[model samples]
Target: MPTVPASRVPRRRTPAAAVVLSVAVFLGTVLSGCAYEYSADHWDDESTSAAPPPSTDAALPQDPHLNEPVTGEELDDWVDAVLPDAAGQVFQTGFGTLEADEERKETTAQLPKGTYALTLACRSTRRVSFSIENGEDELVDLSLRCGTSRVNVVQLAADASLSIKVDANAPANFAYRVSRI
Candidate 1:
């Protein structure tokens, strides 16, 4: 019998390694054929209503900590700066820190029949979720990425008791304002 040299033997890949390699190749092929688009500054495209036209007046100051998460006083200041000025009558405005343990905060405001803009901004370790409802009917529900701002326009055919809920997976600071447009 002749003994074969170790260098002449073919290496055998483990089942786990083969599965991983197959998954990588499959994902690469599938992803390469799909086009993914993202906008860091705009709200989600599936929002129920379109955002109002940008104000042509002097633009507000840009977010100073656009690329990083912020907490404490810095988050409060960021929220204040990013909130849009009341173009018409102001219905509600609030700013506060959402503690990590608390997870969520809810508030309600009575708004008269009119068109209004709901602006929300947050600085957090993770994306924060927002749900806005007029009485029992949900108006807007979306999760905003950290360090971004969103403005949603909502119409009230009749007077409504508007409720806004904010939820964060971790500690965060947030601000929201509802004002007639």
Candidate 2:
């Protein structure tokens, strides 16, 4: 290589710090132009406002027979009235009257492997306790108030025996139905 004097060598004309400061200033100017401001007049315009749509649902009908006492055929009729859409093949249906002295009543049914809805209702009673079991395993236990009905969904993995026991606080009429859904 040919030898060159120290002052004769060429060097970069621009310093790195100057180039970085120039880039920062350019970005700040560009970003400031994108700022937005909202005014009261803009919000007053209906076209830019957000409002909820009106509801289309009507009020539910009242049941006049909810507080009445019923038994035997009338008990069954009440169940039908409450659960109007009992849609599905019914596996079991039971209706009976419980005496004030009776402690409880238990019923059993053989249900195939499937999903089933168990509906229970009672009238003329203070409260009633319902216990449902699949063989040795208790599936559902609930206390139902008089003049009301409750539906529980049970899923059976295999064909099994189901036992339902109802205990009432006062003499009342009760009805139950098990249907596959």
Candidate 3:
């Protein structure tokens, strides 16, 4: 059988530099996550950006459901894949009796639309990012390279609220959000 060239596939519109950074983030963050080493170094991209802190009295969801946090497993499912080295290192620590809210949805929080902020507590700082794709395969691949990964989540207001919760015994917890400048 004849083989098709790798170039046959359309390239992502994301800049090559951005792809490198995103991959770096995946390699740096996911490896630790899969190793069960909780860390926030993963959000070095999101935590360092210009996203400002939100006011407590700012807009909020009338539904208490929005106030709830997103779980690690939920975030895991959204992750399409990981660095080649991290593929076999996934370590899960299950402690909850309550099931994840499957009906919950994600509304892109990046500005000028709106920024999404979330909190993640872990034993290390190497866990970062969310790659979500709808039917069109338009994926959200934030990385340290594009400078969209490091934002103070609590200060950012999201069009739709989401969260990432590690076990309480985990090391560090981050409260972050993504929104327009």
Candidate 4:
């Protein structure tokens, strides 16, 4: 059979095939764009220039009985009742209380060589920052929102010790307690 020359052959165009190819290309482009947009919006981009917002649930819940601002007298009474023994007293000595207009306070405690769980409760009506430092290292650094509490576990060597620093910005006299787990 004689072959038709390229210039002499008719170019047949199928409309259905063209429609199907066009639809496929359109769908591919749209889906790709949508997927890229979704990932860009939801993915955690570390390179973002803006600072990441803090977590809303970062604050811990406080005990019902000790979730209010306390006067010095009330704080003393509460401490005596809640921590009634030598062991409690030993832990309580590490806590700091902030009266109205007080600038700042720091308390230190020497933990024996062992693993211990530490719990901090803040009964304040205003925002405050509580940080626990083990020697030169920071162990627990958290901004205690109003009426928030926190708990952490710390392991200490034979000579390790910790300091509790409280910075208050509220007018209400606040009482904070640190106890061993």
Candidate number achieving the greatest lDDT relative to the actual structure: 1
Model 3 over residues 26-125: C-alpha lDDT tens digits? 9988787664554767556667664666667647645533223345874343222211112221222112212222112244322322333331221122
Which residue segments of model 3 deviate by more than 4 Å? 1-125, 132-139, 142-174
Compared with the true structure, model 3 gives a TM-score of 0.19
Per-residue lDDT over 36-67 for candidate 4, one digit per residue giving the tens place of the 0 to 100 score: 33556556676676577886774776565444
Model 2 CA RMSD to the hidden true structure, in angstroms: 16.6
lDDT-wise, the better of 1 and 2 is: 1
Candidate order by decreasing lDDT: 1, 2, 4, 3
How far in Å is the alpha carbon of 46 misplaced in model 3?
42
Candidate 2 lDDT, 66-164, residue by residue in tens: 555676676667777766667898888776777765556565667789999999887763776788898898888988887788899999999987888
lDDT on C-alpha atoms for all candidate structures? 0.79, 0.78, 0.34, 0.61
TM-score of 2: 0.58
Instruction: Evaluate model 2: give its lDDT.
Output: 0.78
- Greater lDDT among 2 and 4 belongs to 2
> Could you tell me every candidate's TM-score relative to the true structure?
0.58, 0.58, 0.19, 0.47
